[model samples]
Target: MESKKKEKKALGLAELVAIALGGMVGGGIFTILGVSVSIIGFMTPVAILIGGVFALLAAYSYVKLGVYYKDEGATYSFYKRTYPKIPFLSSMIGWFVIFGYISTIALYAFTFSSYMISGSDLAESIWARKLIAIGVIAVFALINAWSVNGMGKTEDFLVYTKLLILAAIAFIFFQNGTMPVSEFFGKLQVDWEQSHVMSILIVSSLTFVAYEGFQLVINGVNEMSQPEKKIPGAIYIAVFLVILIYVVISFAAMLAIPSEEIIAKKEFSLAAGAGKIIGIWGTRLVIVGAVLATSSAISGTLFGSSRQMAVIAGDGFFPRILARRKNGIPRIGIITMAVTASTLILVGGLELILEFGSVTFLVVSLLMAIANFQIRKQTNSSTILTLLAILCLATGTVLIFYYEYTHQWEQLLFIVFIYVILTVFSWFFSIREKRRLHREEFPK
Candidate 1:
């Protein structure tokens, strides 16, 4: 009986990779392209590669702590266990990380809605998109609540299919390019010469959110087989593949489409660009690819992050009801995530959600790196790499803030206000936990 139970829980590498990639490739490429291009033009791919470097650095500590702690709570669990004496810090990380996940989910769902309606007469209708986004989130939340195996199989199909479609789109654009690849490189060189280094760096920092989902691999520690091997294998492989996909596809898009069009269309730029280059069929293909990408990402995120929510709840940092599991599914947590993400979709704009998610994840990953550094010997992490992760992540966080402050101070204030709310809630939970402990120790 015990053996059967263990066998049932052993998720293979392919499924794990699907989870990571599904969580990633969803909105990262689709969303970052226009924004990055608007800032650095042809240097978008270079900034993407740099963001990949940030992701790699961040992954170093996540992989280390994930393997060491083996907790489904992931970012929150890593921090809590590493600094067991600081309950407030633990609660705070939990709030930030969960909302960060919520923000990403909102971004994915909104992108999904954008592409879904890109060809329609109502494409410009914000409420229409919000309604579609809410509907998709609810659908995926139900899918996740159904069964883990069901969600994994669905993710495998969506993720692999989207990758094939996306690769084909890139190849098609490459073959039909208006200019030779060499000429494209020549233009990139000239564009780089004309661009500012700080703008490039800031865009790279912004792209950090696109690479945010790689750490979701750690959130599945309990389900996957061989934590020691699969955790690092899935994470590293998925991150590398995503970087390649982003660069190749972005290069292909820039090669074939005009930069002004991509910048103007924003979230639906790929479909719009493809429409101009290859006509309506190309537009449809891009839309299909995007919908699939964001769908898988939404599913993978709801699966992993909801479990993490349950773990945090079990630690008394959230409502106790979230801790309950039925058939190994965190049903309440899953539903809560869907509703909250839907709320964010209704309340936030695309760029606002994007920047907020990038900042939040960068900050959370930086904290994870710090926690890993604190227990490097136990996690068997290299001191140099861990410190590098911290420094790079800190720089990325600051760069985003600087960009927001200089260009959009109102957005910066709203982000800070959200953080203040999260901190207040975290503080309340931590204090309540302390009172409970005191009651136990001192007697009522």
Candidate 2:
């Protein structure tokens, strides 16, 4: 009976780390690779490494808070609990985080669709891609609604299998190099001087989105054993692994593919590069890897973010219906997230979705860092490290907006508009909750 009970609890450290990696390694890498290469040329790996450093800084506070609170509510819960007096701030974080996940869901689904149709006649058809994006979200939302154990096992399989495939792809790039390794290094040195320092930092800031999903591990605090240990361990290990995978893959893509072509097919650069270098089979393999990567991302995001949404709704910060769950799974929240993400995919372009997700998460992570810093003594966190985390995240947030302002001012305005709308809704809910509390305190 003891053995059977242990077997039923399938998400050990390995599985939890897999969830984090599955979430972190999705469409962000595929989408950002070409853009990074275009901006920094062969020095793209350097930018990726810098991005990893920023991710580590951001993770420090998250791990501290995760260990301190041990709430499955993760981001929103931590903030709300830390400063109970500011209910509106917590509501804003909840809305921002959920919508952030929604945007990334759209991002992963769009990337999946891009690679799904990479070799087909409908590859250039925007409507066809959008339709497939919606279909994939619906499929994964159902999978999440079905069972937690099933989602864990599926995530483990997809995460590890995609890692293997990505490793194999990297190996192929090195073994069947179109250009000599020396030539690639030479290009890097030449590009190094031509590339502005700000450009590399900007690219690094953009890559933060690739590291967004590692926090999903905290959402599994309810199911996992010894979360205080597992949450921090899983998150740190997962972030390191994702950095390795991304750096290796980015280097390989640059070595195998020309910069011009990479920039040309920015949406599906990996597939395009593999097709050019290794022919049709390589392209097909990359497509398979991308499909698995995005599928697991969609699954993990829906699973984790929906639970947070349900928790927020229970607190009266969102719709009460979202609080309903079956067997500990938030089915309605999952479905609602899927629908909203699908709507985003239909209406928004890939760049808009990606940038919105990136900015939203950066802002949310910055808040987490501040929350952890406020309770650093209680959480037993290094105050210096926590403050550094705050500094780095704050800088990254500013850099992202600066990048947008310089390059795409229109999109910057659109993002600002969205934040305003979310803040207004959050304020409305917070006020209502306060009034209700006041009534309960002294009933008329």
Candidate 3:
């Protein structure tokens, strides 16, 4: 093991809740909101609500497992309990959980740079934007590297600020937007007013991903004070809060701007939409909020990714160095995650990365939900909830792949290609590990 370091103290329920909130309140809200609304128009809120239901179902699966396992595996943990023999595949899927967050962090860095450059009218300076993004990543990593407590406080404070800003956006939207509630409600179905059902579903699934933030809470089970009871409560609260905030914020953004404007800009593109209602300074303020929301999302994701890596390495699957902790921080894992995410950034275009990432993440969640159903047969938690999680995950998976086929086959295949490559590499690692063990035993 790297440095033979011991596991750090368990994180408290509040800290875990903050982690969950930070993940759910991630960088996407400000950026994707504009995109979803612009494409689907006012019906964006309905779409989010639809996504929210699935989120809650997924949350219940984790909530149930979190109370029991209180381990770091998240989805993989449940699977490990079932299929102990082929844990490599389970772990590979667990890697997707990390991949989703790490990629999102990269998105945050890029988005933050975009806003800083846009707000400063320096969008043309590519070098400066890249430098600033690196700086943002360094700043957050350094903070968490110093103290986990600092991350907890940072997320808590950011959560409140983020929520208040969202509330303010709703107020600005209600006061000045010309779009009627009737018009908003009418946009619910696929029609000429918006796009086709496939377009709406793709956007909805993308929007559904915004709800992926609840997965952040899984890590909290290990961190919570009264994990058995408190962690589940926190999950419900965070999921509910995420749903409410997203619904309100999306409604306002769509009302204030045309659907076309929203799709082009996405999430924090709310600044411009809000600007139409509250003026330039008001929009600028929202930009500042977007920076916080997006950056905090990165910080939370970094922390979660690091923790997952440390746990994985400790299990003897990965290089022992990844388990090393300095000042209670897995610096190696953090660096590795940062490097991995930045590498993905070279792919460019937020929508593509997030879309592909969502597919992988949703599949993992489906696996986790299914695991929960199997576990419930062996445990005592509500069978109803486990069944609900299964149904929700199934619906999401069907919609996700359906949207994939219904849109562009090549793009979807490209994502499947990435997963296949990773699986192949995982197989190689397993075979090599087995050979090394055999050599150690016989000294041949």
- The model with the greatest lDDT is 1
Worst 10 residues of 2 by lDDT: 2-11
TM-score per prediction, in order, is: 0.97, 0.96, 0.89
Against the reference, the lDDT scores of all candidates come to 0.88, 0.88, 0.71
Q: Please tell me which model should have the higher lDDT, number 2 or number 3.
A: 2
| Model 3 CA deviation exceeding 4 Å by range | 1-12, 186-202, 220-222, 346-351, 436-444
> TM-score of model 1 relative to the true fold?
0.97
lDDT of 3 by residue, 283-384 (tens): 887877777777767887787778777776665556779989876678888888877776666556555667767887777777877777777755565788
Among the numbered candidates, top TM-score falls to 1
How far is 291's C-alpha from truth in model 3 (Å)? 0.5
Query: What TM-score does structure 3 among the candidates reach?
Result: 0.89
Q: TM-score of the candidate numbered 2?
A: 0.96
Ten contiguous residues minimizing lDDT sum, candidate 1: 3-12
Query: How well is each residue in 1-444 modelled by candidate 1, as lDDT tens digits?
Result: 886566457567888999999988887787789989888988999999999999999999989988888888899998899889999999998998898889889888998988898768989999999999999999999988887788888888999999999998998888877877898889799989999988888998988888878888888787777898999999999999999999899999888888888899887788887887789998899999999999999999998899999999998899989999887789999999999999888786656756677788989989999999999999888999999999989988898999999999999988898899999999999999889889999995
Q: Where in model 2 is the C-alpha error above 4 Å?
A: 1-10
* Candidate 1: C-alpha lDDT: 0.88
Ranking, TM-score, top scorer first: 1, 2, 3
